[model samples]
Target chain A: MSTFLLILITGIGLGALYFLVASGLSLIYGLMGVLNFAHGAFLTIGAFTGLWIATKVFPNPTTWTFIFSMFAGGIAAGLFALLMEQLVITRLYNRHIDQALVTVGVSLVVTALLGGWFGFDARFLPTPLWFTKAATIGDAIIPVDRFIYIGVAAILLIAMLSILKFTRIGLIIRAGVENRSMVTALGINVRLAFSTVFFIGGFAAGVGGVLISVFSYGVSPLMGGSWLIYGFIVVVVGGMGSIAGSAIAAMLIGITNQFANYYVTGLGDFVVVIILAAVLLTKPTGLLGKVSH
Target chain B: MLRWKYSRPLLIAITVIFAILPFAGDNPLSKAGLQQTMAVAFLFGALALTYDLLFGFTGLLSFGHALYFASGMYVTAILINDFNVNFLLAILIAVIFTSLLAVLTGGAALRTTGITFAMVTLAFGQAGHVVIARDFGGFTNGDDGLPVNADRLPDFFIGVVNTKYLYLLALGILVFIYFTAWWITESSAGRVFAALRDNEQRVSVLGLNPNRFKLLSFVLSAAMAALIGAAMLIVSGSGSPRYAAADITIALLLMVILGGPVTRWGAVLGGIIYSVLSTRLTVLSDGTAFDSLPNFIGGPLAEPAFTLGLIFILIVMFAPGGISGAYYRARFKYLNKGK
Candidate 1:
């Protein structure tokens, strides 16, 4: 029973990370009709930048320093994403296929550049001591980092939901996701929304990157690629444009992965693939997906 | 620009030149080192041609092609090494198995079009990669990789002295694949494929099931990729987990785009050029030439992927039609000038 509880909590932590990456992917695909291959690059950049700050600026980081590094990572990644939109993605506006291809190119170049710069090895980040501590709840002793992940993820989710619910940009984005042509016809400058969506997605991915580094205790050039695949799966399973759907799907996949890995050894990844296939075959539109294309 | 009357002769001439390249005297072409490189180039060229059949002709942008290729490589290697099967029979069995696998996966993936299809295929491909890396049932041997057993009854295929046979074999595979792609593209089914690419709804209106044609193209492309995989195992003498990576499919995409999609030879050209550049760049990176340059500038230049990826982005931005598109444009302008 204790083991089950531990696995369940751990899986939620994993799911939290997935939601961070998937939220951005879902929003971008919803608004722009692009599968951003460079999203992984954004995550990688965030992770490396966070590492740089923790190691260089604050060799012995306090809680405040650590939080600052995380935000710094997110902001850097967000700016990079904005530049990508203004420079590369904007030029091929309306050409969804070319946009995807260019993103793929960007991902390759960024990953290669990171590998060249970082020497392709995993570098452990400096964390606050409390992050390494554990909390005892009943018979289940949970690592404090899991709570931090869950906490940060919950805050971000609420923040995003509120932004979507109340803001002007949020209204435009919601309408744009429904009918991009209609939104344009309404004269609301959908292009600005496009850049905004990319920035938000990049910021989420960057934060996710920092959290992932904390979870794994290190950062590597190729780390983002693996997580990005899961993010893609979550986006598809959760529906293309739905945040609530993504959160639910993320938890489902994460818990399933943990249980499968525990019960059958090397079957965790295989089971996740099975789930994806099942979902795709049964409901191609995903759990809450409205768009048929 | 060569007229239609001369294009056929020019093609034959090019083929003859490649066929006889191994005997071109003491230059780089005649050496064993270069022969191996060219053989790899030919293998990729064939693989790219198969990819072209899907993306260029049929408009299916699949991202999991490496799954089939890796299946062919690993299956053949396992059969030969573990079961002690003959190399030829192993390859034959691997091809058959991969075709069935392709049918199953392709059937499922073809249910979605465009980006969804790409993602579905990617999931399947990643599944294959994981399975291989995990060493399921101890068949794949995990990340250490599986090397081909040379004693399994093929003399000409083994040893450095007989690199020419491997070279010729690669050339033969490339030629066979080229003609097969050509035949398929020129057939009535190929016409339907072109139509499907342009407009799937119209193809359905014409009373042909677009899904079936797409499945056909998918299976054919996958099976051919598997064959290339088998050939690659023989050429390189081993199979590694990298064969199943998503990056391989991306590289194939790069080749198709670089050579100019829709034109079969353009894919082949892209494949050849990419393979050569990738191999040579590694050698260049390891050399002392970059030692004198600044770290920031030299570091990126040392990685071939950076340069290739930059070029890929530029091409997608500027030259949507690739090298073949450029050639066609120049030819059109020259002919109009003559008038």
Candidate 2:
């Protein structure tokens, strides 16, 4: 019973990170109508940025460093995405097939670039000195870092949702998703909305990087493919353009992965994909089914 | 002149030139270098045609259609290696099975269009890759790649020693398949697919159901990819789980975009250029300062993702229609503008 609980908690923790990543992807898809294939690469960039900060800047993964490093990573990733949009996304506007080709191409380029940047050999950063090594409850043992990831993800998610719901920028983004042309017609500068959404997406991914790397204990070039697929699965299964749906789908995918790892010994890696396929097959509109465009 | 574009003779001429060129040469060219490259190009062209039918015609971009290609390769391997079947029988079985798999998956995938469909397809493709990778004993041989015996092939047929026949066979199949795709693309159904690509709602309102057309395109595309997989196996003699994954799909997508998506010859040319530039250049060439630069730029750039980044940057910056598209676009403009 307790093992299940520990797993659930762990799943929720990583699930939170997945939510952040998927939400960014969902928003990008909702707004731009192109699947941002480079989103996972951005996550990796963010994580690597955090790692760089931890090692180069702070020498320890303290709370202060963790918080600041994530923001720094987010800024780098956001700027990177803005440049990509200006160059590639602008050309791809209204051409869905071309957009798909371009985005997939961009993903490959990003992955290739990151692979060169990080090298094929995976890299890691040590656990922060401040956080306790482990947490125990009865027969269950969980890493405190996992909980920290969950906390960080939760904090970021809440902050993002609030901004989306409450802010004028959020309203413009919401308006943009529904009618991009009208937003422009209103003299609202839809470009700014795009840039803001891009930044938010990149920022969420940046924070997700720190959370995810700690769980995996290392970061690798190969991580982008898996993460991209997972994020897509989450967004798709939850429905396309819904933030709430992303959260729900992330938890489902995350928990399913954790449990599948435990129960399905050999085919552990394939379960998420199979489950997602099944979901998509059964519910083509996905769980939320809100986004039509 | 208009009829000559997709005419059977032109395609036949192209195929025969490719087919005879291998045996026509001696020494260096005799070693099946260009032969293999053309074979692979035709094979990939066939795959890209399938992608174009899905992307160019039906207005779908299936990110994971390579699953069918991989499935065909693996199934062919299974027939030859496990069940001791002949190549023709194996390929036939692969095509049929791949079609069925496509129908089952495409039924679900075609329900969603654009990004959602891409994701759904990718999910299934990755699922297939993962299953193959994990199953060490039964299917995939756990990433070492499942093997097919050359001993199964007869003595006149390279004794498994000669890959030249395989190259010619691949070219033959490619020409055959390319014509098949060309015929379909020019057909009324193909027009419907094109309509769907331009505007699904308008097509539907015209009483042509977009979903049905999308489903049909997906199935046909899958079957074509399966055939390509058969050629891939014959040429390389093996199919890894890796070949059927998202990575290969990216390669095929790139092939299509580079070629100018809707054009029949363009796709083939794109595949040929990419295959020659990527495979033959690295595999057959004597190590030299000149050859090394392209490899260093495209090959030893080491890391699957970096090549993607470089290609994306280049395609977006300069070669928007891919190399073939860019070439053709420039030529047309030069000729017409000068006139």
Top-TM-score structure, candidate number:
1
Candidate 2: regions farther than 4 A off = A60-63, A129-132, A266-269, A281-283, B1-14, B25-28, B32-38, B156-161, B201-207, B280-320, B323-339
The 10-residue segment with the lowest total lDDT in model 2 chain B: B281-290
Cα-based lDDT at residue B300, candidate 1: 74
Model 2 pairs in collision: A108-B308, A108-B309, A109-B308, A109-B309, A112-B305, A112-B306, B57-B193, B258-B322
The CAPRI classification for model 2 reads as acceptable
**lDDT digits (tens) for residues A105-163 of candidate 2:** 66676666666555657788655565557788787887677677777777877887898
Per residue, candidate 1 scores C-alpha lDDT tens digits across B1-339 of 434567778988988897787777667678889899999999999999999999999999998999999999999999999999988888899989999999999999988877778888988998998899888888988888888888884898999978888999999999999999999999999999999999999999989999999999999888889889999999999999899988899999999988899989889999999999999988998997677888777777788888899999999999987888788778778778957
Determine the C-alpha RMSD for candidate 2 after optimal superposition of all C-alphas. Answer: 3.5
Q: What is the lDDT of residue B185 in candidate 1?
A: 96
Q: Which window of ten consecutive residues has the lowest lDDT sum in model 1 chain B?
A: B1-10
Candidate 2 local lDDT, B80-188, one digit each (tens)? 8888998889999999999999999899877766666778898889888887777645766867887778788555455334668777677677768877897888899
Query: lDDT per residue, candidate 1, A1-293, as tens digits?
Result: 88888889999999999999999999899888988989999999999989999999999988998888888888888899899999999999899989999998998899889877776789998999999988888998888898888888898898888888899999998888888999998778998899889998999899888889999879998888888899999999998988888899999998899899999777888888778878987888788886654
Off by over 4 Å in 1: B1-4
In order, the interface RMSDs are 1.1, 4.3
Clashing pairs in 1: none
